[model samples]
Structure formats: structure tokens, C-alpha cells
Target: MANALPLVALLVLAGSAALASATTFTVGDSQGWTTGVNYNSWASSKSFAVGDTLVFNYETKAHTVTEVTKSGYDTCSEANKLSDDDSGSTTVTLATPGTHYFICNIPGHCSSGMKFAITVSATRSGGTGTSAGAPRVPAMASVVVAAAAGAAFIKLALL
Candidate 1:
């Protein structure tokens, strides 16, 4: 009975910790290219989880979170998407765990310092040393990464 109690308590604590670590972040804040935008520092900012999905909500001006490769840094690359001018949404799921580079494919955007980056960490397994896969965490943490600088919400999840 004593051993069982300790085991149960540990399980409960682990579950709670996982829930707390789960986070969500908006892709685009309520601002234009000037200030108060999410993309401004997204490159060295945003975060990701194993099964997290990045929700790109386009509010104004056509934008996209296209995947790119950091010249010298070797990490995960390739996954990307372009925002739809009409509905304005581009969702991409983080299947593997690694760092992903993203930037606006728009002309003058990337050059004008309109670059974004995100780090996707391994998902929290369900006790068996594997990710719990909780529908993707909104994001892992907030770093120097800037926002999209448009009218949109780039949500990162941890699944």
C-alpha cells in the first residue's frame, strides 16, 4: 500500500507538469509592419513541440511562413506554406523534433529583416519516455524571434 501511494503521487505530479508546460502563441499580433507585430522578431523567437501545429492567420496584407534553411546552422528544413489572400490561413504540423527556419517569401520582406524562426522540441511522451502528443503545444518558449508584423496569429502547439 505504501509503495502504491508513492507511485500514484509521482504519476499525478508528472501529468500536472506536462499540462503546465503546454503553451500557445499568436502568430500575428494586432499591428502593421511598423510595430506591435509578431513577425518583427519571430526569426529568433517562436517555439514548437513534436505534434504542434503552427496556425497562420492572415488578417491584412498577404503573408506566408515559408520554411527556409539557415546558411551555416544545420537543422530541420523544408516544411512551409503560403497564406491564402482570401481566407488567410496556413497550418503546418511539426511532425519531427528539430529546429525549423521560416521567412516571408514576399519580395523585400526577407531582406527587410522580415524573417522568423522556431525550435520544435521532442513531444512529451506518455510516461513511456515518449511524447504525450497532446494536440501540439502552442509553442515551447518565447525568444528573440520576432513577429510576422502583419495582421495575423501564428499559433504554435505541442502534440
Candidate 2:
């Protein structure tokens, strides 16, 4: 029964670590979303994860942020867009781990270097674990705690 106390404490710590806050990235930084800005360089400087968000600040009428598929992004096509936003200040949540593509749908904006692609890593913890964009320690620790607590409960029951 006493051993169970330490296991519970471990569980609490694991839960806290897993609940770390998500990061918010301002797309294009101080330059804001506009033509002539080097989006590829900006995107390469940061690592994106699933709970993170991309905040696009631009002029509503002058530009638009459009999410497109890989093929569309490759060709700079706006014909079949996955999602489009023209609110000038749009926020896109990274809910999945994969390559996401974005472009300005203005007539020649994408061709004028207004497109960027970001590849979200599988795990934010930066390890060889298989958690996929999530912290691995908390998950592994939770499993250990559960097993230890279960064994302790069984031992108490047998007593």
C-alpha cells in the first residue's frame, strides 16, 4: 500500500508535463504576410508541432491565406483550395503532423514568392519515440504508473 503513494505522485508529475502549453507562431514575423517576403526562409527557422498555431497577419483586400494540397502548392494553383481565409488576421491550428502548404491566392502573389510550406515533426519532445508530436516521457510514465498501481492494488487485495 505504501508503494502506491509514490506511483500516484509520479502520475501527477507526468500529467503536468503532458499538459504543457502549445506554441503560437506569428507567420512572417514582424514583416507580416505580404509579397516579396521570403517565406521559405522564415518557415525553415522554426519547428511546428500539432497543437501550435500559425497566425497570418495581412491586408484583407490585398491578400488572402489559402491552405492547399501538395499538388496545388507545387503548381501554385488556387483552383481547388482546401481552405481559404481573407480575414487579414487569420489563425490556423496545426491539428495534424504532416507537411502543410499555404499560399497567397492573389493573382500573382504566389508566383511573387508569397507561398510557404511547413513540415510538422511527429514529436515535439525530440527523440526516437513514437508519440508523434507529443511528449513521450509523460506517456511512458503514465503506463509505468498504471502498471505499478495495479500491481500494488493486487498485492493489497491478496493481503
Candidate 3:
């Protein structure tokens, strides 16, 4: 019983640390997923790692986020896109370490500078922390952490 408090505290802290490690980057940073913004250049300024996320915000019907292979990206071809979305907001997690390509396949859109490539490296030893201002702990996780803390306190008091 005496050892439980430290264990619970450690669990809660570990969860928080995991959350802190991941980053959610908003593509184009206010300019959003639209034309005229240099997406590849935009990506160059940051370091991408597996587990990081890219968020594309745009008009619902105006553009589409098309994930494609290297060839597809080079040709701006929509024939074999890996994924496609036009939901005004798209969130994509970097699941693996490699260069991923994205383009807005709306005819001239891709040719007219509406595409970018991001390179994701394997996760680093230490977490980069949530630099994009995403919440570290979810609401449910917070509740659980609070309950565990309270129980630990009660146990310590009893001891």
C-alpha cells in the first residue's frame, strides 16, 4: 500500500509525458491549406518525426488533400492516391519514417503550387513536446489522474 502512491503518480506522469511528446502542426500556420503558400518550403523549417501530426485547414469544397506516392506527386496524378479528403480540416499522423507527399488535386491546383512533401524521421530519444499548443492530457485522462491522486492521498493518510 505504501508503494502504490509513487506508482500511481508515475503512471499519471508517464501518460502526460507521452502526450507532451507528440506534436500537431497546423499546415501553413493561419494561411491554411490553400494555394500560393509554399508548402514544401513551409515544411523545411521544422523537424518531423514519427507520431507527429499534420493538420490541413481549408474550405470544405475548395480543395482536397491527396496523399500520393512519389511518382504520383511528381506527376500530380490522382489515379493512385493513397488517401483523399475535402473536409475543410484534415489531420494526418506520421506513422512511419519517410518522406510523405500531399497535393491538392483539383486540376490545375497541383501544377499551380498546391503541393508539398514532408520527411518524417524515426522518433527521437527525447520527446520534442507539444509545440503546437495541443492539450497534453485529454479530459478523461485528467479525471483518471485526479482520481488516482486522491486515492493515493487517502492511502497515505491511512498509513
Candidate 4:
């Protein structure tokens, strides 16, 4: 029992770290998804990855978060929406790699620059240790290696 404690702890820690994400971007930052703010510029300042999340925070239902195709995004058309959310807050997970487009389907909103596009890499950034099988962060890999070594030592001592 006592001999197994450290191994258990190591497993738990690794599990927790694996479940973490690279980033959770609050769209538009403090400006909170709204008009007059440059959402594309906002997106440009950050790196997006698979398994990361995007939170759209707005003050009212006057705006929407609409996921659409490149054509829809280009034309600001809402006829073929992949997903649409009118809630003041919308959460979207970047599940796959490639370019993703979002726009406000409300009339005049998207054309007014209330839209943004992001390219999600197939990787998690900044050593997030996400479950997406993102490249192992060197430091985290070291910790995991050390932990494994420690557990092995403990097992040997028990013998």
C-alpha cells in the first residue's frame, strides 16, 4: 500500500496534465464579441490548436456565432450554417486542423467586419500536454520520465 502511493500519485498527475488544454481564447478579449472591434486582427495575435477552445462573450443576444463554410464566410451568407448560436456566450472547441470561419449571421453584422477566421494546427502549443496527442513538451516529458523512474525504484524496493 505505502509502496504503491508514489506510483498512484504519478499516474494521477500525468492524467491531469494530459487533460489540460493549450488555450481558451475569449474572443475579442475584453472587448467581448461586438461590433467596431477588429476580430480578425484579434485572431492574428494568437495561435490556435486542436483541442483548444474559443469562448465568445458578448453582452447581448444582438450578436451570433455562426460557423460556416468558406463561401458563406466570404459572402456573409447564413443559408448553410454548420452551427449557429445566439447565446451571449458561445463555446467552441477546435477539434480538427485546417481553417475555420465564423461570422455573425445577423444582417449587416458580418459585412461590418464582425467575422474572423482562424487556422488551427494539428498541434497544441506552449507545452499544454493536451490529450490530443500533441507533441510531448520536453519539460513535461522529463517529468513523466522521472516519475516513471521513481515508480520503478519504489517497486524494486518493495521486492
Tens-digit lDDT string for candidate 1 (58-149): 64446555666674112222333322222356566666777766555555555655555667778644322112233323332321122221
lDDT of 3 by residue, 1-159 (tens): 766667777877776666666688889888999989988788877777777788899999799999999999999997889999999999998899989999999989999989999888887454453336653344557756676778878887898
lDDT of 4 at 140: 58
Pairs in clash, predicted candidate 4: none
TM-score of each: 0.46, 0.68, 0.79, 0.71
Q: After superposition, which runs of candidate 1 have C-alpha atoms over 4 Å from their true positions?
A: 1-24, 31-47, 59-61, 72-87, 124-159
Model 4 local distance difference test score = 0.80
- Tens digits of per-residue lDDT for model 2, 46-72: 777776678899988789999999888
Best candidate (score: TM-score): 3
- Worst 10-residue lDDT window, candidate 4: 129-138
Candidate ranking (TM-score, best to worst): 3, 4, 2, 1
lDDT of 3 at 18: 64
Q: For candidate 4, what is the TM-score?
A: 0.71
The lDDT values for all models are 0.47, 0.79, 0.82, 0.80
Q: Backbone clash tally for model 4?
A: 0
> Stretches of candidate 4 above 4 Å error?
1-11, 125-159
Number of backbone collisions per candidate, in order?
40, 3, 0, 0
- In model 3, pairs of residues that clash are none
